[model samples]
Target: MRKLKIGYIPMFRGTARGDREILERISKELTDLSRTMDFDLKIGSEIVFGYDTAVKAVAEMNSFDPDFTFLGSYGATIGSAMIPMDKLKGLIGLWAVPEWELTGRLPLNAFCGSMINAGMLAKFHTEKHIPFKWFYGYTDDPLFIDRFKVTFQALKAIVALQESRIGLIGPVVDGFDYMLVRESSIYDLYGATVDRHHSVEEVIKRAKDQSEAAVKDELAAILAEGSKTCMVDDEAMNRFARLSLALSDLARDNGLNAISMSCWTNIEFNYGNAPCSAISRLNNKGIIAGCEADIDGAIGMIISRAMADADAATMCDLVSVDRADDSLNIWHCGPAAGCLANKCGVKWDHHFDMGHYEGDEWHGYGVVADLTFKPGDITLSRISTEAKELTAFGATMFDKESYQGCSGWIKDYRMGGKPMTLAELLSVIYNNRVDHHMSFAYGNFESSLIEFANWKGISVAKNTGYVDHMELGTLGK
Candidate 1:
């Protein structure tokens, strides 16, 4: 994958003298941060202290073309910084570096300038329809960095989607007519190009072509990685290994960032096995695969992965509701991501119930990684295109440690609104025509998603209904 590029523009008042020192200090800090941080950030070298200089710097940075531009006010007042901002097409964000405390007057006036710029840009962006974000804090604060990183990742995901090529192999499961996505709609809304491969036969053929030695080696690796194994006989392991390798090659050969595969009737019945294990393995390795040929689910998985810093995300059905505990059960027949598996480790298991279970032979070699998801806060997101318009919604869910074999409960749920009853939540989902499958990754990414929605000019009517206290389950009464 390509590294996320971020251009840094240090700003100061045009008439402000003796500001170069603070500017240099902040620049050097960013340089050091770029080397230390795990996420990729490409900081630009130029500094802006005037309208003319700002225009020149922006022009130069434009040539470099960053995913987002960071406009920082270091010891300078907020004046005409908006001049350069008008030219940028990507997301624009502001950094209000905290003022260094002293016995006398503030040295940088950084916070004051940042706040002013924020207010000014808020109006400017609103009137001009420009997308922007702002943060006020010390450079190294963990919370500040975390929030910024979330925004950064969101921008990265948006850019990735624009540059991505997604593959849809085979048709969606029958009767899931709603899940069939129009490629033109994806291109129009997200700029992602989709290619449809009409047959799962190609995947099976590729799996069969792998050398036996290679398949055995992959099987050994899988066994070693698992903390515990169950019912994973040689046949299942071998089959899964071949399928996994083949899928990896298919993705690489096609230059696909993600894939949506139809896994029901054709691949499972004719091939005598489900591709759940292969899907799980691909997700663990960062090649997102959505089951039942869910293109939007694959896109949502990629979005969650990027926003959560490449954390593994899975596409799962909202299979059951637990009103007693006020949670929803998220399950997908054995395709839960292996990386999200709890300490108990992933189990080699069979499909839930999809097979010929007659007297003599049960031909379904389910071949799946089974485990309860690890307990943590998670975000649920789904993207859809209906009526030629793109719509998406995101909310946070608290996953519990309590596991029942191959599923996890979203015992805690919060959307941007007043605290809601389980019924109210269900009503919201039902009323909005949400898809059955939702993509989930571990993190509280509600704010990030909202910001992304703003930048993309996508409607946020379904998501913008909550206050922060709702996240704490307080309802903000």
Candidate 2:
């Protein structure tokens, strides 16, 4: 997880009595909390008590370039809080402390100040909007701490997306037109860069150029891990190691935080090997990798990783729905990280779908990791084409056998705080026209994902069952 930088703006009215001491105490509490939190807090050198002081304080805070700013409403005038609220680039937090005492002449009308500031900012930001969150209660309050932590987690995920550089190794697969996304739209929406100059041939050439010793060492390490190797022989494993090393080098050479590859007919037909193992290896190493050149899927994996504090995320297809058992099966051509494998462990085997191809040589594409996902709470998410929207849901993986390849059975799915039946979930997918691929991590991140979408202004689809309005007029009543 990335550590966030937070700027603190302490506000006070110059004429108000006893505000200086209260502001100082608030600063001390925040500074102490920062030590325990996963963020760095930068407090202004002096409190803002007037317009000129507010301007100077804004300059000082802006120099820190915080990912989020906290405005301590310590009996401050609306004008003072407005300076940082308008000047800061990211989300601003309005923190109002409880009154110090109920006795004579209210020492600090902090809550009233915060309400006035919120009203003023809301009116001023009608045209050019700035996101802000409200907080009440003292720093030691449990509710305050919980909200603060959740916001921090959401901001960290947002920052990760803004800083990501994704490399697309090839075009989307032949029939998967739905995976296509405009690179410019991705940048405009998520602040992530998409580099498409790298080609499939480059990866192949790099794989071939790897030194024999390095390939042998990688193969040895993989074999030493005790995964049962099925039809795949030592040569096939060696080929997978070379490709894995090549992909790793490609990401490093291009400075990519994530990669999406076609990983299909071209690589399988020409290179005589599939990249499922390579994708798994890269994901395990914290370099997010997606199969079939799904750029949005790769971005979703990156978001999952960030939300889950860098846990490896897997991209899988919703293969089947079992109504009797109330479960859904998620599977892919063996690209899941080793850490997600069940106690049965990973199995190196042939790609299940390659046998349908015509040639005898196609049978040699035997290097996929076959395993079941370990039982845990899982969060599934996806970004739509053109980066226009996002969807996320929470489910629990059942501790039961799954079909061949990297797969899992998930039950008890919920979205938008509502428990969804299997039919309802299917309806949501159909109505929304969600992509076939969804990325998942080993934790419940529904709230974090929603928060991230809110922060970025990305639409969140919380579909429940089917929508009557979605029917065509000619086909419906």
Per-residue alpha-carbon lDDT of candidate 1 for residues 228-344, written as tens digits (9 for 90 to 100): 244346676777888899898999999987899999766877676778888888888888888888888888887778777755788887778776777887778777677788777
Whole-model lDDT values for every prediction: 0.72, 0.82
Which ten residues in a row are the worst by lDDT in model 1? 468-477
Model 2, which residues run further than 4 Å from truth?
14-18, 80-84, 102-104, 226-228, 356-364, 385-387, 465-477
User: Over 4 Å off in model 1, which ranges?
Assistant: 38-51, 74-84, 96-128, 140-147, 222-238, 359-365, 385-405, 417-420, 461-477
How much lDDT does candidate 1 score?
Answer: 0.72
- Top candidate by TM-score: 2
Per-residue C-alpha lDDT of model 2 across residues 240-338, encoded as one tens digit per residue:
999999999999989999999989777887688888988888887889999999999998898888878755898999998887898999999989888
RMSD of 2: 2.9
